[model samples]
Target: MTEPAPLNGFGPLISFILSISALRDWAKLLIIGSFFETCRRLLATVWSSTIDSFFLTASFEDHDDSYKWMMIWLSKQPSWKNVRNVNISTGERYSGNVPDSEGESDTSGMPKVCYLPALSGSYTLWYKYRWMRITRVSEPIPGWGPNHRDSLNISIFTRNHDILNTILQDAKKAYQDAQGSSITVYISDSANCWRELATRRKRPLDSIILDPGIRELVVEDAQDFLASKKWYAERGIPFRRGYLLYGAPGSGKTSLIHSIAGELELDVYIISLSRSGLDDTGLSELISDLPERCIALMEDIDAALHNSLSREDTPTPPNQTAEFIPSSPRTPTHTTSKVSLSGLLNALDGIGAQEGRILFATTNKYSSLDPALCRPGRMDLHVEFKLASRYQADELFKRFYLPSSPKTPADDDQEPKSNPAQSHLNGSICDGGSTDLIDLGVPDDVADSPPSSPSACSEKSERAALTYTGTRHRGHAPKLSSDQLSALAAQFASAIPEREVSMAALQGYLMSQKSRPSEAAREVSAWLQKELATKKAQNETKS
Candidate 1:
């Protein structure tokens, strides 16, 4: 009975609405719209499937090396010259093989400029007659502030992956060609991820004035280690080597390490042990993440682990100075490193350590290091670097003042006219001069004459016109013959007093007298006295 009463109310309402012409028209329009919308969606799905079957897409993350290769390759593309939209970047990320759009020939001392595809913009390019679409997008990282992850999406019209492989190979080759003359240096970021720091010009191994056999020993050992990977795999040994360069501050330890890296053609990854937020886990991760072949450098290793070193538990000898033995164990500050000695030791030669990495550790206080850290499996070779010796000083002086360019045959043929004063100072057999003591007093500033003031100018202008009496910028060294240079180098070495001053100190003193090799040799004795006196004062104050 209830169903029957409702049937009539529904039927009358439906009939009344159907009687309206506008309602019928509205119903027809609604059905037509629904049909068209359904058809549009179906077509879109079909088109997407067709694209998926025919296109090969690849994505390169900014953190990966492929991203760098692709960016470098894209910058060298001929299409960029005609493209109206681009991103002009001053950062080193896109620095390889990019032409300067500003038309400046001499870009030295200026920030490198690179043109990249604008962010969020799609670019169509042709590679080997195949069509490719490139899209660069930035997505926000979960917790990193103000930092976003970048990815390069490339879709080519061919389904064959061989084309993609070809593109990658060409891109890598371009990148390598651009980086042929330099070594890339990398450092860890706050997230403990490696980031490219800079590309340093390869430092010639000869430029590092280390003791004889030191440079060759380190370089040859590293080279051998790199070539011995298969040998290590057969013996079930980890194919890794470590070098410990411990010596006085300002010695050539760091310089030698850099030169060895360049000579080996390996990238340098600097692990700042004192970096904030670094713990044992982070250190282990960093070491494990190192590429198969790389130079991992840790400078001033003792300073970072002063509190956790093995010597902390041992009693200091009474004769040892505070420099060698800390008065008190340094507690790790909030901003300092939290890496323990055990963590560092494990990270160096742990099971997860990279197989072919070369670890270089430098320290001024070798006695303070843990014996476990310097063990054979960890630090395979230990090299002691002392202060500048006579040989190092002589070599350093010659290298510093020597002309960079090669000399002509005629210039080489001409013999140098020996100077009696220099010969006497060098103690050469060609000079029979008296062995009287040379004056060691500070030389007078005879070359510096104050500019005369203009009588018509104001006092401010006159003061401004006065010569700047402060430290003057150094100029090129005076050209001298080989014999003269040899004699001057001998004289400079003689005044160095044998291992009393560091190579860096000697280099600094020579830098002050860059254009005056004779003055550098003549005034070295006076400079040494002041330097020794200043050291004594510092020691007394420390004591």
Candidate 2:
């Protein structure tokens, strides 16, 4: 009775339990909903992966072409036959766009767009069917979509490898067209080395907090430089740029390089050739093996040379005859030995050093450098950071003081102009503007009057009175223009007497201007007089 044959094929029994039309409708809806949901999930996965991958497709002249015929012939010879990879995808079969997972058919009428996977090996084949499609074909247009057949095998394996000759050939043609002129070419030899020195600190970047205005300038230069490098890179030229920073000690030259690296998003490799034991061979090895796309620094080259020179003290005998001369050159005895100048020069830009390399050298004494080192062809650029001007003063002040300033306007009528003011602060202020006085607590009358010349302002008591805060503890102060104070800071920041002045002394001078109107003018005036005296003496010595 329980079985009654279990009502085999019980469609009639189920129909009696449930209405037939209703059941049929529910089943159809379930099947349709499942199909739509599955498609959506598949589409989403494909889009996610596409965003993470970047493909580079390039075309070049073939073996039969005049420019690449020799290269192709070389690749075919038994001795060099390994250069050609049958696995590479190439040929006329790919006259149309390469197929993608997505259904997009239009290629803007491009004849070929072959697909290249992220091939990691040194020798990859160029062929239509040999390559594996790592991506599903069920998504929207791929990142590098509408692939065509002009896909040529390119060498992404080694920088020195000749596989990219075609790309280079194309790049040269494109570059010439873009520039509308001929291009100069220079290739680094493969024999020189850049010796990187060890430093106590891993990164010499902490000083950026000391000078943010200069930091910003460094960033702007970095952006321009990187953009230029990229332009060259896309044209298949080796990417490189050179910079020279020369100035007084403590002028933030080294600090500036570090900030530039941080701003440009690059790694910095410091090569101190002065480390006592490096020689031509050692330097050459370092330069040849440098990691690509990193900074190479040769800090204080002048100092390095002086130290090197001091170590080579093989003086001539007072009355030695020609015959008495040693057959071999005598090695000088010194605390720390170094390579010769020729070695250093070769290391600067020898053919053996790595390509796409950036070199930065700093010196306190530019005049002392050999003509070859700082010349246009060697360094490409030489920038000098001079003594602070009035413009620089405003920069330093804005950098040091702006962070502590109030963000909102004191009065509702003055809507916040923080962004505009910040932008303006990067450059010079023509005259003491209305806002400058209001911030400084100057008399509104003085704020409204036309600003006087810096020298005249230095001479005027009222002008000094405008900046003084009256909290002076070091007693009588001097009157100084913003320009004069800036000059003093630049000149005396490294001076012997100014170096002796306690941080407290400097802070006292800066704080005194915050209160007591009577002596504000006198304090700045006296400070300016001493600073000008030092500056004049410096100019005379240089002259």
Candidate 3:
């Protein structure tokens, strides 16, 4: 008693289950079905086989060339050439493969396809005469926790492995050539190769607040490094540069590095030592293969060292007295990292190390660093970033406002106020500012550097400094004359006690004032007085 046949058979279910792309490919398959049928019979009669196939699987979770190649190739397939419905998204990418223009080198304005209805399920990827079936899948990886990220599994099957490998390599090369760089970041997940580091575009150098001396030093060194690559080979130098940037967290240490990368037209390779599975071998391999003229940055060197090795195992200098900082609340009871100080030393300039590399190590705990690690050959330059200074405070005010000095007021009524206490009136502190009043802490290179696309904050300032744009503030209000601006800058600088405030704190204060320079100045004055009072009170209480 085989039950009565169902009204609708498996035929209807098959049609319903097949995706549109799959259906289209199936039609093509049927057209060539006879050809394949004839070959199958011939092969079967001769070799007892119908066809050969190579199966390849790719995952979106992978951050390597294999995954990158597959995903890029999939995007170029003709099957989804004319998808009816697509989701597009914009992103900022910094590619290391191409020379960057002056500004926004790390940015991309292109839109990416996020969702393709036609390629949502099964599809066909055809290159040349070779073709393969592609299926999109989302599922958890075996042995991973349930909360782990889902990976998109892309399966490709073809009759020839040669075509698969060749097409993939060619496709990657073409894609990179067409797009220059796609804002990809590479890192080490293990001892094998560098994986992409996921991060947003960084601030330009001009956007950062730094000592002019350091900026010049960095750029000149970069120039020397690039020009001397061949020279180093001609001579017998290692052709490597190492910089140590140590300071408080918000002192623009990292921002300066990003700016330098853009200015030098080089890519940045960041090393995150905290990443699990990284050891001495992996670290050494990473350093030895750093891109030429590229910056190999290891941020928070002290923290990584702490996790990698025990405190007693690390060393300190005998002559330098250590400054005592309160223990961080996040002290870990135990760590599995095997990174050691010696291992780091070996990674930097060991025999296997690559030349034409700009290495930067940043940390707030300068005192904790072993003198051996930062000795002459390892870190050639050690630059300390201090808190806000009088010069910096003046620059901050000028940055928050326009750089041009206000036009000489035709009448006294239009003159900018000179009183620090009354600067906030008329909605802007820079209403009657002047550029000639002070050098404003600007650098020679910054003034001399080509003013292409300026950094967000540096645009107006550069124009004023370089070409004297005399660009107005947000409301198009005229700037103060040089005398007025100089007076205002002096007042602002005087109000800020040198080395007493952090740039981060000063920035926060300025932001709170909105774009009102006068308001920021007044409030900052009151705030400083209160801070001084609070410090005195705390000191008395402690005593």
Candidate 4:
């Protein structure tokens, strides 16, 4: 009676399944599969542990300097030539050109291409007789939409950690060598992180047309400060220096800073105080995060804080009279910057401020700044950059028109002779000082002739082609010896009034007459007269 009751539910089904031979065989197969899977997992765990013990793994994030070093090193590896899967990058971060496989010159003005390991791909290469594996992975960053973070993982098949250090040293050396000719410029992002903006060619200190002894003073001071770190520490003073370059706009303040950075082999970190979303706390954080032995630039420092307070908020001078005050109701200039004067002061010399960093602040209005900001400990040295002087104008003109010196016989003897025709074609002298063009059947009349002008031209076109037209020309200047350049430079400087025009204006004037040094010197008085008259009229209008 109990069996009859159970058959109504599952009793009949269980009995039917147990009676089938195929069902029994299926159950046995399920048990066997489970056992094999367990064994496979156990073996995998053991294999992973063994590999980890013998392998050294290191990871480099894309944002870090080491990542760039590794990428450059990897690009030069012989293994990449044979690799089929790779990423082609034209970014400056990779540094140097990838050798063309077909040995053709790239004259297209395109950025150099580099081969990088593809994302999520594994690559193998040998380093110092040790097998190495590189894997580049990209992962989505949380809270950043559509933005991913890249990382490089390197696994070396060795038990010694010294091999990794050696590889890193080699990579770092290669990166330094590649970057030797340029200086890296960094700027802060909205997220308050320093990002590489560009790699500027190292501008020689001589190329900057500063007044005599001004360049020497700033450069020597910076060099001495950098070398006197131990002296500062011994005296219990912070190993930091600040320079205040206050004067006229376009007076080579920023250029001087850039040249100093290049001369000192230090990277430049530009601190934009008026940047959107940047506030007091952000500025302090940025300053604190600056690297040691780096240049921290804050340009237009006065403008950033000039309009921070309204006229009513600003304290009236003790010497001021009621009549001296402006009758018009003055409103503060609107700025996206939330940085205050106190915030900037603290950022410059706070306890958290980075040590050994050289800070450079430039301002067009020196007298407008608070005295506390220009104090000894904060500003240290205050260098005034007035408008361009006659010396600067003279030096600039010579630099613009002077040709590179010819090689001496001693220097020429060191170089091995290549192709005679090619050397002559490149303006080098062949036997009897004849050019390769003559041998190529070119007539002397055609070779020596100047560039031809258009047969038909309007009066406007002829005037536009004049040196004083204020239009830029790309033609090469006539090759002048040092003495000839000095004569032209002196004549040009005589026409330029001292401390009236900025170096930038003179450079612009020179750029317009790039191919006509003689014309530029002769027409300087006319250009200066027009420039000064225009400036006076503008000033009168403003008044």
Cα lDDT, all candidates: 0.78, 0.46, 0.61, 0.78
Candidate 4 ranges beyond 4 A from true positions = 1-47, 100-106, 144-146, 309-332, 404-458, 462-469, 472-474
* Candidate 2 residue lDDT tens string, 294-315: 6777777666645442334344
Q: TM-score for every candidate vs. truth?
A: 0.79, 0.36, 0.57, 0.78
- Model 1 global lDDT (CA atoms, 0 to 1): 0.78
Worst 10 residues of 3 by lDDT: 320-329
Higher-ranked by lDDT: 2 or 4:
4
Q: Best to worst by lDDT, what's the order?
A: 1, 4, 3, 2
lDDT of 4 at 423: 34
Stretches of candidate 1 off by over 4 Å are 1-46, 101-108, 311-335, 406-474
What tens-digit string does per-residue lDDT give for candidate 4 at 1-543?
Answer: 455444466878888997899998998998999999999999999999999999999999987889988887887777767888989888887755366558665555578788888999999999889999999999987652236789999999999999999988988887888787899999998778788899998889889888878989999999999999999999999899999997776789989998998999999999988788889999999999988989999887666646652222345456542222212222226678898877878888988889999989987656556788888878999998778889999999988887756766654655556553333333322221112112223355543442233322222234334423345343357888778889999999988887778888899988877777997898889889988898678666646
Clashing pairs in 4: none
Question: Could you tell me which 10 consecutive residues in candidate 1 have the lowest summed lDDT?
Answer: 430-439
Q: Cα lDDT of model 4 overall?
A: 0.78
lDDT of 1 by residue, 15-46 (tens): 99999999999999999999999999999999
Q: Could you give the C-alpha RMSD of every candidate to the true structure, in order shown?
A: 8.6, 23.5, 16.5, 9.6
Candidate 1, position 501, lDDT? 83
